[model samples]
Every structure is written in structure tokens, then in C-alpha cells.
Target: MASDRGHGITHCDDPRAAQLSGLLTRRRQTLGLTVEQAARATGLAEHRYTALERGAGHGIDLGGLKRVAGGLGLTGQPRETFLLLAADPDVTPYDLVERRRPSIEELAHIDLMEPNPALITDHAWNVLAANASVARLFGDPGRAADGDRNLVLWLLTDGAGRRFADVDEVRADAVARVRAALAQIPADATLQALAGRIAADPLGAGLWRSRSPRLPAEASARRLRHPLYGEASVLVTTSRLPGGLQLIVHHAAHLIQSPAPR
Candidate 1:
């Protein structure tokens, strides 16, 4: 029995190492290649190839490894594993979001809102992105102040108040809308930045000072001067998007009934 047991049986040392080594062995076995045949094809001796199959060989040439992989019908497997393993083990699926942020920003221009003035706002109601009509109607008026856009401030402050038919009602509703929007935002950095900008406005200051966000049961109507439609009253509706992006869509109200000419 002692004479029959020639050299010691080679076994992989580490469990993870053994698992990966077993995987390689399986790959080689699946290709119907004997150990000697695999070694000869990759220019390695049978003993060295056996050590590799046992997951004990180091200093194996990468090019030769590729050849051995090819001989073992692991051409795609090595490439796929290289790709999968080349990534940092600490790298998580969440890191993919960071890499894909620009794509999401690009998608913001995908024209989600219709032609009637749609804008993409982050939390706190400060417009981060806007469409052409949005830029034309609201943008031309120089809505940005100190790099901040508080819609409530626009309705309550300076010459901007004249833009709305009844600034008081509009300001109150806008403030309420901001509060509603704020409630939906998490403590995200983007949201906090917008909130900080908005809070810099005088009306926002007052709203913050009150520390009370009231939602009136009755929705109010407000009029705005559209670049094309002179004056229009739109019943503003607020909605939350999948990623907490704020979408403001303005629908032209029904034209008031007119008396027939005598």
C-alpha cells in the first residue's frame, strides 16, 4: 500500500482557492483535455499544469494562460472573469449610479413634458433644468437672483410681482407648493442645495421664519403672461416623479365664454 501510494496526492490549500481551482479543473474536464494534453498545448510540463489545476501555481505567464484557457475551451470564460474580477471587490452596484449620473442628466432633455412650458425642478422648487419655452417665458424675465429661483419670491418681490395678476394668492399657493415639494425630498445634497438657495430669498425667509407649511383645502387659480398667449390662467398641478424630480406642467385654461355679437 505504501509503495502504491507514490507521490503525495495534490490538494488545493485555501477553500476559496480550492473552489476557483475546482472551477478551472471542471472547465478543463468539460473540454475533454487530459492534464498532459493541456500542459503540452500551453507549453507547460505536466507537473506544473497539475499544480495550476490544483490552484498552487504562481508566476504563470498571462499569454500562456490565455493559450491554456483556449486549449481548455475557456476563451470567453477568461475574458468574462477578467472583466468581472478586474472590478474592485469593494466596488458595489451603487457605484454604477455615479458612473451613470451624466446619462441621467442627459436623459433630462428627453422631452418628458409637452410643448406648453414644462420645466424640471429639483426639490425646494428651484429650477435646475428647463425646456425652451420655459427658458423663453420664465427665463427671459431674469428669474435667477444670486443663482437662486424662489417662485414665491418672484410673485412677492419687486417688479416681479407685476408678472402675476394677483401676486398675493399666487405667492401663497407657490409657497404651499414648495412646502409640498419639500416634504417629498429626502435629505439629499441636491435638494439641500436648492433649499439653501431658495431660503436666501426674502419671501422664503418669511416662510422659513413661520416654520408652518399650510395646505389650503381649496386650490386657487392664478394668471400669468405667456409670451404667446398674452394672459392665461392655469390651474397649477404638482406631481412627484420617480426619482423625486419635480415636473411643472402648465395647461392653458378653457377660454371664457363669449356673448354672440348682436
Candidate 2:
């Protein structure tokens, strides 16, 4: 059973636990405080604080870490690191935190109601959930993957890849972003497989290796075509959620046709 910590936060995945515990212990010692004193200052039970200082903050949430950080006089990036590490450790075990599935369902429902198309990917870039409008316009996510479902894989390998006006540019951008993301989780088997598949493919291997990676744009105007829509201008936006999830939304941008010069 999940403890009353609220987010079903689990224990740190070993290495992260040790690192965090050591940092907290050192910080407390520098401040010259007993565990009980530190716990009281942080608004945590002494045992809970002890568990955290001992590299076992797995069940701890961001707020708890914030309290600890405040008690430790930790500010700036060090404080942020504590919050981030608590929410998502360095190595996720396929599924780390128990996602509030109902909230995701709600998000999908709301997204589907919009005129735009939206899809959600898990940490490994697998297209786990999507809205109805996307399937209606683009090809179905069902036929996208050979076995596992990844949107980037589908885009790189599928015939629909040709639908972009600047297909090569689109492809290069996608490959670069995927490469950069995979760098963060080297031990992830799914990511390794994806990287291997990309590297082996004649189409994307060169692009993956040669292109300079760019940070993924938060939002960008893109052009795509469909037999029915003819061609549409889309504003693509990506938002990040806790637990390494990403929500990608495609909103149709209103393109005002300018008068042709005489």
C-alpha cells in the first residue's frame, strides 16, 4: 500500500538514494544540528528525516524535499536537484511512479474535444495514449510500429513521412531530439533498442550521427499535408509532466494568405 505521502512516491533507485542521503547528512553536519533538530526544523518526523538522510527518500515527495531543502539552507540548483530527483530518479524501472491514470484520461478527453490533435508519450517515447482526431487525420497509431509503439519510429519509417513539405528537415530534427533524450537514460532497454533501430536503418543512421542536436522547440510552426486537408499549417507544442511523460499537441494555425506581389 502507498503511504500517506500522497503521490505514491517510492524509494530511490539505490544510487540516487545513496547520493541524496550523503548530501543531506553532510549538509546537516555542516549546519551542526542533530537529526531530531533537523527534522523539527523541516517539519518532518525525526524517523522520516532519518530515512531521508540515510538515502531512502523514495517515499518522499517534492514538498517534503522542499521542506528538507529549506531546513538545510539549500537554495538554487542544489535545491531544484533535490526536488527533481525525488520526483523522478535517474533510472526509471520501466514504470516508476504510479501515474494518476484518471487524470490522463481526463486530459485525453479534453484534448480530443479540441479541434487540434494531441498525443501523449511515456518516458521511452512510446505513444501510449492519443486523441481521436489524430487517428482520423493521420494514419492510425496501431499501424505505426512493427511491435512496440513509438511515434518517432513511425514518423521516420512510415510512408506518411513523405507528407511533410520539408521532410528531411523534419526528420533530422526528430532524430536529433531523440538522440539527445536517449543520452539521459543509457541503461533503458527500450531506448537502446530504439537507438539501435535508428542507427541500423539506412534512412536515419547518417542523419542521427551527423546532425548537431538542437533542443526541442517548445512550440513551432510546421507544415504538413493530407489528402483531405490538402495542406495545413500546424503549431506544434510540447509540454512536460512529472515522471518523464510528454504531451504533444498540434493546433492548426490560422494562415492568412498574403496578397501576391504584382
Candidate 3:
């Protein structure tokens, strides 16, 4: 038998709570207003503001926090804090606000094709979901490992780069895919962070600003030197899915032809 008493509570760890509380108090104090004055300005009662500053178990609302932020003249992304507060059931007033965060399974789907390497990436370019062919082609079906392994990273720095007979083409494909994903997630923090990190790398930075239209999907055979498959010319097909969860699926264009070593 197991207890579900603490099932959904997050950020309950004392240090985090204390840290957030301290931030709240400092922000308020920085405004040079007493608790009562701050509460009056923010349309909250003094006690409520005090409890939030103390990080007491009282639930906080996103709108209320936005008001507080407005009153204190704080700027930058407040959505992160809003989401954190929304995750705490005890601190949230809106039921919809407290719904569980979305999972990758819920965000994107995949389909495998035999004898071809294929996979789909979410708007953040995180390999949210991949298919069997992708694993077989990459020689590791489990390489994606959820959303942690960035495909761009593998193409840029890992041994995966050795498989491309035409490194330029692969780099072009990577940039095209990244640009497509960026179009779908222009303001996503996770994607922005990734773009920033990639931009720091000279090779990656060069492609970051490429304005080239997407490469045509007309079946074209390109040499690929797979660690396991030796050298082969693999035809590639790339398809983009529009809206919500932006996805791009890539598959071998010539699954039946035998490729010669480059």
C-alpha cells in the first residue's frame, strides 16, 4: 500500500520555497513600500501579500502575481513563476490553471518506416518522438532518450556527423529543420535557450541566420556513410507538419536501391 498524500505538490522543498519567498520580499522592499502600502497598490489585502512573501501554504494566482509584479515595476518573463504557482494545487484558484503539465506523448506522435531512417521533432527541436527506422538508421533506436538529446547537437558535434557523405547537405538540413521549428516556437523559452547555446558555436552560429528556403523534397540520392551500413547513397524525404506542435519527419528516399561507397 502506498500513500498519495504528497502526490502533486511541487517546489515544496524548503530551500526553493524560501528562495522564492525571499525574492518576493526583496522585490517588494525594493519598491520602498510597506506591506500595507504594497497590498493597497496591488489590490491585495496586506495579510495575503505577507503570506506570499513568507511562502506560506496559501495558494497564489497568476493574475494576482502579475498585479504584484506590475505594482513593483518588475519586468521580464513572469510566465515561469506563474506556471510554478499554477502547479501547486493548494495555491491555485483556477482549476484549469492547475492542470498537470503536458507530456511529450501528448505533444507529438511518430510513425516508423522500414529500411529508412525517419523521426519527427517537436517545435523545440527536441526529439519528442521517433520511429524504429530512425533508430536503425542512426544505429541506436534509443538514442533520442526522451527530449534531452538535441538532434542538432548530434548532427553538429557527435560521431553522427561522420555518417554524412556530404556534411554541407546535412548542415543545410539541420538549419532548415531548426528554422522551421523556430517559426512555430518564436517565443518559447526552451527553444530560445537552445538557439542561444547553438549560436555561441561558430559552426552553428553561421547557420542560425541562414535565410535559405527549405530544401526541395524531390527524391535525390546522397551518399551516407553509416557506421554499420558502410557507404550508401540514401534518398531523403522531408515533410513538415503545420500548426500547434510543429513537426518534421525525415525518411530515406531510396529504401530499395543499393548504395555504393562514396
Candidate 4:
């Protein structure tokens, strides 16, 4: 009787739908799973799974999306990103990136944090602005070579040499964050290239492939061997800012007393 598409299945033409479809297909292929295998893993019928991969299953519910994410072995922020895209295929992290430049008010706030190392970063963790304290603690990002001002990049590459006492732990966490961010904005060419560079490094590649828990934004104590200030202890905290930016602060930092040499 009805001729639109037989069983009332409507084709979704949304660009986001296409993006989601591509992600699903790529992820399945990356895992070396066949369509049937993916369907089984997702607990969905073969045809339904295929439809989703074709961007034709826009009507899938949240429960269905959750099953898909779980079936794909996605965890932490990556899982959250998958569900978010499923809910609204049109979401883009670019809006936040577009507004990345810190406002005068934000700059003033950073200034107020004086004496405590503070910096602002965009969604991709590019160092947008930093206070004088941050420059003093970590070398000035402004002077970094083009495309080298990213927080994660610095952590993965320069952190250990810079005397970060918890370099391994910090590097792993940074890699996890990058992985999640990549999933959220799969279409970003810049981020894709950055990920490639990170994967090119042996340690970074190992950490990227390994599973790690997502760290919360709770304050954590960190030890740094400051070239000038000597060994120091600081409490690091991160907070979300407007426009998909992050405010990271190193608070209450003081030089650590070294035991008298024998």
C-alpha cells in the first residue's frame, strides 16, 4: 500500500548521520569485525546494524546506542562521545574552537590567578594563553615552534625530560584524553594529523593502544624539578570554561626541601 519505502523506513540525509555512519563503519573495520560479527556484538539484527552503518537508522534509541558503544568496547569519554553523536548527529566541537580566543574578562581572571601557574586551552588542548607564572613553570608556550604548543604533546614528549615526577601516569592520562577528543571530533583534520604524530612515537603508540581510566578534574599533587626553582610540589586542578575551553591551574606550589646530603 505505502510506497515511500515499504516498511516505513525513511532515509536520513543529515550530514551528522553520515558522519556517525562513517565512524561506525570505520570502528568496526578497525576491530577486524565483519558486519555479522558487529551485529552480534551490538545485539542488533544484521539488517538493522547495516542500516545504521548506512546512516539510515537515525531513529535508534538511546538504549540501542549504548549497546552499540558497549559492543564496540568503547570506554570513558569515547563512550560518552559515541552516545552524544548518536543523540544529535549535527553536534560539532568547532563552535567552541571558533570562540577559542580568550576574552578580556578571561585574561583579567588569569591575571588575578597571579603567582599560581595558570593557562587556557581549547578543546584540542592547544595552549591559547598562559599567565606569567605558567611561563615561569613550564617554558613559555608562545615561544614553541608552530603546532608545538599543545598540552598533550608536551606531556607525551617533553614531560619526562622536564622532570615531571609522574610523567608516565600523566602521559597516559593525556593520551586517553586525546583519544576521547579525537572520537568526539572525528572530522577534524588537524586533530587527525596530531593523533598520527602521537602514534608515531613508540611510547605514545603504546599508551594510545592501551586501556586507561579517564582522570577526573580533581586537584592532584604534582612534583616538578624546576630548573630555576628546584624541586617543587604543586596542586594541579582543571576546570571547564566557556566555549569548550579549559582552565588549568597549578596552585599552592612551593619548593620542596631536600634532605641534607650525607
Candidate 5:
């Protein structure tokens, strides 16, 4: 009789295993490829490919993963995400955020951004830090209630709708980002709770279920409404920091577009 591990494929119970399996299955289906075709494309035996899709295969190293990624036609960020998921299943972006902090020097650099609205957020979209401009523009995350400090939560449930002209577009983008992050860290309780809360809203629930593409890091221009400054078109850019933190900056296209409040 086979051992329990061999018979039951205990590893398949792991969260990462399930994540990989789902990703592979979704990609294959999206490409309209049958299992045999995908197996042939990956240069793997049909049985081996099936086992991989079931999250039961073992001993697939880096080269094999590369072959799989290439066969699936995953390029750019998608390919990189695939490789990282396969190679470091246990790595959690939140852990990186928890273990590191911005140096005073880094904070100084952020301060140099000055009038531009800039803030740092962790994988779960928790606002870790923000400059004065960000505080002035978006309402200081530091002063928000615990639940509202999460950008996604704020966008979906709190007052973000009042701050952006294209609130629907912004909400959709936030949902997509959260979906991608949840796939990478399925075991995170905080993320799971966040997803539940987002799904509680009718519009958010629809967005969560819809298949929307993840927006690029540098988003197109969006109109921001400030109580004192009125409305201005802003371009948002995001840069990855050393420790799973993101530096998001909003550059106004034409600052002071509207007259000041009386």
C-alpha cells in the first residue's frame, strides 16, 4: 500500500498548492487549451501535467517552471508573478512589510516630494505612512478609524467616493489589486476579512465577481476633489519599495485648477 503522503497527496492541502493549481487551471482555460495540449506545450507528460494542475506533482525545479510559464505564454509581470509564486510559496508580502521600516533618510526623501500627495502602503493596502500633502488631500490615514486606514476598505466602504471624480473606476482598480494580492496570500486572515467586507457592498460585490484587468502601476489621469483646492486632474504613479511597500504619488496635472474656498 502507498504511504499516506503518496496516496493522499497531503501537500495539495497547502494554500500555496491550491493557489498554484487555480492559477494554472485558469490560465489554461483562458487560453482555450485542453490538458493534453497544455501538456504538449509544456513538454511534460500528460500525467505529469495533470498532477501539476491538481497540485500533486513534485520535483519541478526552476527550469521546469520556466518551461511552464513560457508554454502558457505568460510574459512581463504575469510571468514574473508565476515564477515567484512557484518558487517561494511560503513567502508572504505582509511579512516583508512587518519586518522592515523606512529609514529616516527614506522619510526625508518622501518629504522632498513636497506638494505632491505621497504615501506608502503595504500589501494589504494599509496606509503605513503619508506625507503632509497626502494627508491634506485624502484625509490623514493616521487619523482614520482602524478599518478606514486600509485604502481598499476606504475606497469600497468609506468616504473615497467623495474624494475622486471617477469613483467607479477607482473602486474597480482597487478591487482588481485586492484580488491579485489575495491570490498570493490566501492564508492571510486580514486579507480574507477584507475580501468579505468588500463583497458585502452591492457594487463592490459585482466588481469582485467581474473579471477586470489589473490596472497598471502608473494609472491614467484621475480627477481629485479637494475641499480647499477644488478639483484637479492628477496622475498616480506607484513604485515598489525594498520591503513589499509601495510608494504612491499623485502629481497634479494643473494645480490650483479651481478657485480657493472663500
Candidate 6:
């Protein structure tokens, strides 16, 4: 999916735009390709490609971004990170505050009815609602420190010291997911503020600088040894709800058919 935000020739002061342009230029140069050569390789017009390298590429389609990334031999974290950076800044699906989300009755029904641990998060990874099972596992997200109700922030910082079988691994996944989410709404001030706080945390900062992709969903199985549910193996699955809400469900190992596909 892409936005018709023009050819992205107009000037914009977004730091991410500059970073992407610089990265594209450097990567192309590293591969010993001139602007014309790289442009031709990616099927982009020469001037359009130049404009893209000059910090104005917010309108690039997903296919264009993928083609560009492939032509440049970008892969793994670097490729994933760059494509996210190149995506247009549209907040509709992500602007939780402005959208009319599902009713509380529906959200609470999942919380109250689900037998396993589950919670709902907004586009910014904020904990919109949590179930008793999830609360029992991670403590009340409402009691999170610094009033940071964000799921990633809560898991890495406020929910610190709580034992997850693989705390660092879990934190890394949280960092990557939050970082990717931020790229789609780089201009959101509220998300930016929370991201700033996340960066201040030593663990979060370390992972943020890496700019890695999140764990593959199909391989994401978390085992927690809580006093309430001792030796419980949980597999995380996410489903999209109306207005871009995300439901995160953690099912007991036996009850889960599988982790979500990557």
C-alpha cells in the first residue's frame, strides 16, 4: 500500500527523510553505481531518483521501495529499516486518538471472556486495555512507571526486573516493533515523546541503535514462569480490529495451535 502524496519533490524537514536520502546515496556509491545506473536499475526516472536521493521520497510505493531495496542489495535489518523509513507518513490507520475505535463493550468482552492472557494496543503500542490473565502475568500495565502506558515502554522499562524466560530477547522484539511503528507516523508528537523516553533507558537505547527487525511472529513463543501460572508456555498472536486496533493474545502452549505466521 502507498499514498499519493505527490512525487515527494517538495521540501520537508523530516530528519528521517534526510537520513534515508543519505543512506541511499551512500549505499549506491558503496556499490559503485552512479545515479543514472541506480535509477535505471530500479526503474525510476533519473530526475525522480535524484529527487529521492535528495530527501524527498515520501510518495514511493511499496513495490517501488521493495524494488529499490532489492536493486541496492539491501537485506535483513538494513533493508527492513530503510523501507520503513521510506514509507509515507500517513496516520489514519495509526492515529488512534482521531479514529472512532471499537466500543469498550467489545474490547472488554475480549478481556473478560478470553481464558488466556490478552491485551489490546493502539497503533503506538499503548496499552488500551488488558485482560486479567495478562495483568496477572505482567502486573497491571496501568501501574507502569513514569506514567508510560506504552506496551514496549512498559515491558522494557516499567516492567523491568519481572522475569520473562528471555527478557533481553523480549525487550529486543518490543524495541524493533515500536521503532517500526514510529516510522509510519514520524511526525506524531505524542509517540515521539514516548520514544524519547524509551531511548533514555539503557536497554532500549542499545536495541534502538541496532535498528533490527522484530522476531518472526511464527517463531515467537514466550514461556513465563509466573507464580500464578507456573511453567506456562505462551505463544503470542495478534489480530487487527476495526480502526486499526491490535489484539495481542498469549495462549497457553497446549491451547495454541501455532504462533502467527511470520
TM-score to native of every candidate shown = 0.44, 0.60, 0.46, 0.58, 0.59, 0.55
Q: Which stretches in model 6 have alpha-carbon errors above 4 Å?
A: 1-98, 144-146, 158-161, 213-219, 253-262
**Model 6: lDDT of residue 57:** 71
Candidate 3 Cα deviation (angstroms), residue 25 = 47
TM-score, cand. 4 vs. native: 0.58
> How well is each residue in 165-258 modelled by candidate 3, as lDDT tens digits?
7876777667666666555545556667777767887878887777453633535556777554476666665454432233444445353345
Cα lDDT of model 1 overall? 0.52
Off by over 4 Å in 1: 1-115, 140-160, 180-200, 215-220, 253-262
What's the C-alpha lDDT at position 175 in model 3? 69
Residue 188 of model 2, lDDT score: 66
The top-ranked prediction according to TM-score is 2
Comparing candidate 2 with candidate 6, which one achieves the higher TM-score?
2
**Per-residue CA lDDT of candidate 2, range 75-164, in tens?**
765766566555555534333332323265646563664556777776656776777666865667766554557767666766546566
Write candidate 4's Cα lDDT for 152-192 as tens digits. 88887664558677788778877887787777778777678
Q: Can you list the residue pairs that collide in candidate 3?
A: 59-91, 60-91, 235-253
* Cα TM-score of candidate 2: 0.60
In model 6, residue pairs whose N, Cα or C atoms come closer than 3 Å (at least 3 residues apart or on different chains), thus clashing, are: none
Worst 10 residues of 6 by lDDT: 1-10
Ranking of all predicted structures according to lDDT, beginning with the best and ending with the worst: 5, 4, 6, 2, 3, 1
Per-residue lDDT tens digits for candidate 1, residues 24-60, read: 6666666666777777776788887776666554556
Clash count of each predicted structure: 0, 2, 3, 0, 0, 0
Shift in Å, residue 223, candidate 5: 1.3
Instruction: Kindly provide the TM-score of model 5 when superposed on the true structure, using C-alpha atoms.
Output: 0.59
* Candidate 3: residue 119 lDDT (0-100): 59
